[model samples]
Target: MSSASRRRPWDVHRLPSAEGSTFLVTGGNAGIGYFTAEQLAATGAHVVLGSRDRAKADTAMASIRSRVPDAHLSHLPLDLADLASLKSVADRLDLDHLDAVVHNAGVALDDPPRRETGDGHELMFGTNHLGHFALTQWLAPLLSAAPAGRVVTVGSFAARSERLDLDDLQSTLDYRPKRTYGRSKLAQMSFGFELDRRLRAINSTVLSVVAHPGGALDSLTPSRPPVSVTTAAERLRALPAALLVQGKDAGARPVVRAVLDPEVRGGQLWGPRVFGLRGTPRCEPVPAHMADAEVAARLWAASGELTGTDPDLGFR
Candidate 1:
């Protein structure tokens, strides 16, 4: 396929019949996650809201129930910053099977300051990448039980500018918060592709897909500069740029499409097509390095050691 004409997963307003399916959406209490959960519930699917804050999860569930009246929804606590909490939440899940998992929780820090999580890794890398890594691994069995399961990891356009700093995965040296965030996002995408390869190799039924919101405007937080504001000129440019950015609803399309579109290929990526930034949902290719077999193998091993969950799951 031509690079520019790659087939998209779905257009706006196209959704699958989710009647017997169950979904788990992290950070589902607000923003794009909330809308995605609401839409799924509207289609008669049972949704489990995964949020760090219990109160927020309650509020989200109440809002959705108020709208759908019969929306099947529940809440679970998940604090990505703490591995112990991740494990606890995983153990408490009642579902024996999961149709899809959307890893939507993320943090965008302002600067390159060194911040550590409960697990002792850089905050962004730990929460954005490692946390999801552990959660997905724990949920692998449930996902594998489904006839056509999907694991959707949310990534970002910033990943294009990131290079895997294996030498300093934790950003222990020359740490820049933005770069670290980009690297973490790259890790999320890389993990999705790597998981797809593992599933294919083992002939497993699970499918893995990665997606980014492009430049979606966040509703839960105030608008902020992208990453770097080296000068007043850059700040000036952000003013109009934010205005032109796509809405969170449009941004959530890729995630929704990735999970619902039957044509979505394992290891495929979905995002906006306009300027490769913000627009409707479409399928796109990730950088070749993101799917490199050798790098993926190394990353899988490293992640297993760091997160205490194996990607291969003994299915070599």
Candidate 2:
């Protein structure tokens, strides 16, 4: 069979049944995260919606139930920007064994000026990179206990903008919104790949994977319980871009694939098949810098230092 035919076709409707599984999705209250949770719950998995606002999470939960009446759903208050909140939520998580944890929450392009959270860390870097780092480490025990646990950290096409700088991870030296966002995503991808290497070195079953949603448009996506009430100005801004992008449900395909596709190996990155914007999920090559073992190790070490939490890789 040709390489094309050897590739398995991935679609939201055809996901492997998630019965008897449990998954946690950060920022699952809106956008692509919400769609991912809805899809997983539809397949009989119990989904824990992690969000900063309980009300928004409740709204997202109601939205999921409206579509999938039997959807098994729970909510956990998680604010990735705040380490205290992240640890509190992580401690509160009662799952015995988590099948997967989708790190899908972060600051988007429209967010305000670069600012530090209460922890004195940049908002995007703290939430997108350091926040997930600490949470994953705290949850490592639960994950290791699972038969085949997986952690899926979301990345972005913007990561191609600038190479990661260990000293300027927060972009304090020079902070451009676009570049800062890209740097955070680069850190996320690097840490994810490095995590896979460490897990493999220790012969652990937990797999670390990275995925990007490509481009998704809020104007084109249907708002169920209304995670955020889109203003007229925002919708107008999204109009032109909406034509070139996919809806939230379609954008979520890559993340779901990364979580459920049995063939997906650790250290592999998945994204849209068409120009990194919108299409079916497919394995994509990680950027040369992002794939570098040395860079990944540096970021991993930096993450541990910044988060003050060392990863528990089931080895001394």
Candidate 3:
């Protein structure tokens, strides 16, 4: 809990050499996802950008190519808000194996009054948690095929403030947009930890880890009118606050570290190690309650019911 300068003395400039590896990063077209893809592609890895918008994806890919002329990159359509879209992308993905899968796609719709997705679940919960749940489940075979694959699920410190309501997971009972967003993130974090447990139980080699940008002060969350406007302005006006907010490059560090670091253990949480929630990357501990077995099992069951997908797949 002590706050100190956690900056690594190592040269952060040298790009991660993921040559000979393949990676699929959801929402890799912009913001933190874009930077993550750019860094990975710079290392000669075969990077596929999973994006919902084709035009935006193409633009992001083009921008990356402009910077790193030799970046081995491509784009694939993936809309986390729609299960059908996720299934389609999963079906079309031809990779026999993947070194890492970065579950970076997420949304934070603050429209209020509880909006439901096409799947009829709360928009934020459905897109951020259930979508990734199904996507990861679908990609299990490919991940298992790798020598030692890694699944990096992006979460947020906002999760710390979340208290999952099992009875009304979709926020149907009492939907506060921001609270629901935090709750959904908590679910994602819980899923990451729980998935690691299940993976080990099944004797799978795929490593499951979670990471957060601390408070990057970026637009990682979906924009919704006043809440978005006010939040953005507050973030911008607070320059000292930005000191706690890592840049996209630095923000992407925990994900990279969790995904690529051989020392990273399954179920570990990585984030900045300073106040304002910004600093060099370091492994941190999630709350004990977040890893509660009963809560995870319940959430897993609820997710399966919502998405119509099985959580337990025999992958020994």
Candidate 4:
């Protein structure tokens, strides 16, 4: 695996031009998502930032523009936590076809009291997993035809050790902040692979790929001005941990590769190469949990039931 990775070639500085493609990135206003948007802008793609905060979206766009003066950009007002508003968000997109969507936006709260979204599901599960699941259903029609479009679901390395509690997916039975967040991402990763399976079963052209930004630290991230600023103190603190992780920008590479790589196939997992923690993007093995068809099918049914509406995947 290490030898093949060293032989596999990819240059982060010279991404192929996407030209006319249009991509919508959830939570594109900050962190890894912001860096992903900024990097994609240089490819000449029409990059749209989706978030509930209009002010932050505006700032993120400006930050990208500061570096790439002619970058095409826009914004979509979206609150994934609110399932009721997704259809309207899709309607407002006003595009005949969308080239790609990076499912990177998520909520990871560390505090004690477990929270819930507007729809009354656990906050992390709702916003991180079910929210994207529901949004994908709404966005299905807008995906490009002929050559097919893509959906890159950004998971986390944290999900590797986590498994969904089939009977209590929302952690209603027990909620530990870190574990709950991990399970939510695990659910999201499961959905991505399962969606690919269903799409292939029906011979659909839409591609679904999964990826995770290993360990990304804000302190290691570069300055994006109004969007983000990495302080010197934070950099000093990160020094002790530099070998094990990377900056948010570096972390976004796997997602970018998943989004734009022409040779990449559906169901592939793209992630950091070295130690699966920090390095350039490379294809990695899909962990056992993510590859479990039986479990994923069950989760799919549960998600379809919980989400309360469906778009045509081959199964249903």
Q: What TM-scores do the predictions have?
A: 0.86, 0.90, 0.88, 0.95
lDDT of each: 0.80, 0.84, 0.80, 0.90
Candidate 2 lDDT over 195-263, as tens digits, reads: 888888888889999999888877666656466455578767777886567777788889999998888
**How much lDDT does candidate 4 score?**
0.90
Which candidate should be chosen as best, given TM-score against the real structure?
4
Candidate maximizing lDDT:
4
Candidate 1 local lDDT, 1-316, one digit each (tens): 7854785535467566788899999989877787778778877889998987888788788877877899999888888889877666646887778899999988879775689997888898889888988888778878888889999999988889888978788889878888888999998899899988888988888899998888875432222122111355544555666555765667778888888877788989999878667777888878887877787778777877888876564333
Off by over 4 Å in 2: 1-9, 88-90, 109-112, 228-243, 311-316
Model 3 alpha-carbon drift over 4 Å, by segment: 1-11, 219-238
> What tens-digit string does per-residue lDDT give for candidate 4 at 135-195?
8888887763426688899999999999889999988989899999999999999999999
TM-score leaderboard ranking: 4, 2, 3, 1
lDDT of 3 by residue, 181-220 (tens): 9999999999999999999988789989999887775533
Quote model 1's TM-score. Answer: 0.86
